[model samples]
Target: MGANFISLSLTFAYLAQSFLFDTQVYPDVVQYQLAIEGQNHTIHLEKNRDLIGKDFTETHYTKDGKRVTTSTHE
Candidate 1:
């Protein structure tokens, strides 16, 4: 029973460390905004130049009484 408890604790610790420090599992996201013809557009993507001007999906949200717009690459 003691050995099993120790193994379970180690497994949990490994999972916690992976969740806290693994960058690939939680990639960095950047937000960009563009304005054209008096209209505003917002997108969320990685900081890569090659990804610009690609197809994406737009999402809208409301937080703290303000509308938020975000986009994800398709």
Candidate 2:
């Protein structure tokens, strides 16, 4: 019984350590569609980007066919 308890304790400790550490889960970027109604704004949850920290909402419409994006804020 003691041997089984020690083994269980060790397994629990290992699992606890693994959960506490910062495992690098793949970083991600998400795009959101902003809906504005007469100065009121509502943010919507969109899809995730394949590349981490990528800007998915870059402006594509312009008089000269130009697209630009500012700094990303979380």
Candidate 3:
């Protein structure tokens, strides 16, 4: 059964690699999409770049979320 063992090990290794690179899929965006065990999620977040660090503005009565109207160095 050595062939079966090798196949199973390879499958497990692939899964582990996928998990480690979960954050790699999201770049230059404030949110991420992830799926696990048939459950999915869209996580909201704010990231700092070279130009500005953790800077954002939110206005009042803005029903829309993540609607960036103003930015730094404008």
Q: Highest lDDT among the candidates is held by which one?
A: 1
Report lDDT per candidate.
0.50, 0.40, 0.47
lDDT of 2 by residue, 1-74 (tens): 33321111111212445556848353232223333332433333333555556444544557887776554542
Give lDDT tens digits, candidate 3, residues 1-74.
Answer: 43321111111222546668767653444445556445666666554556444565544445665544664435
Candidate 1 wrong stretches, greater than 4 Å: 1-27, 47-74
What candidate 3 gets wrong by more than 4 Å, as runs, is 1-29, 48-74
1-74 per-residue lDDT for model 1 (tens digits): 33321111111223556668787644455445656455666666654556646566565657667666555553
Which RMSD values do the candidates have, in order? Answer: 20.5, 20.9, 14.8
Clashes of 1: 0
Model 2, stretches more than 4 Å misplaced?
1-57
Candidate 2 lDDT at 13 equals 18
Error of 3 at 39 (Å): 0.6
Q: Estimate each model's TM-score.
A: 0.25, 0.17, 0.24
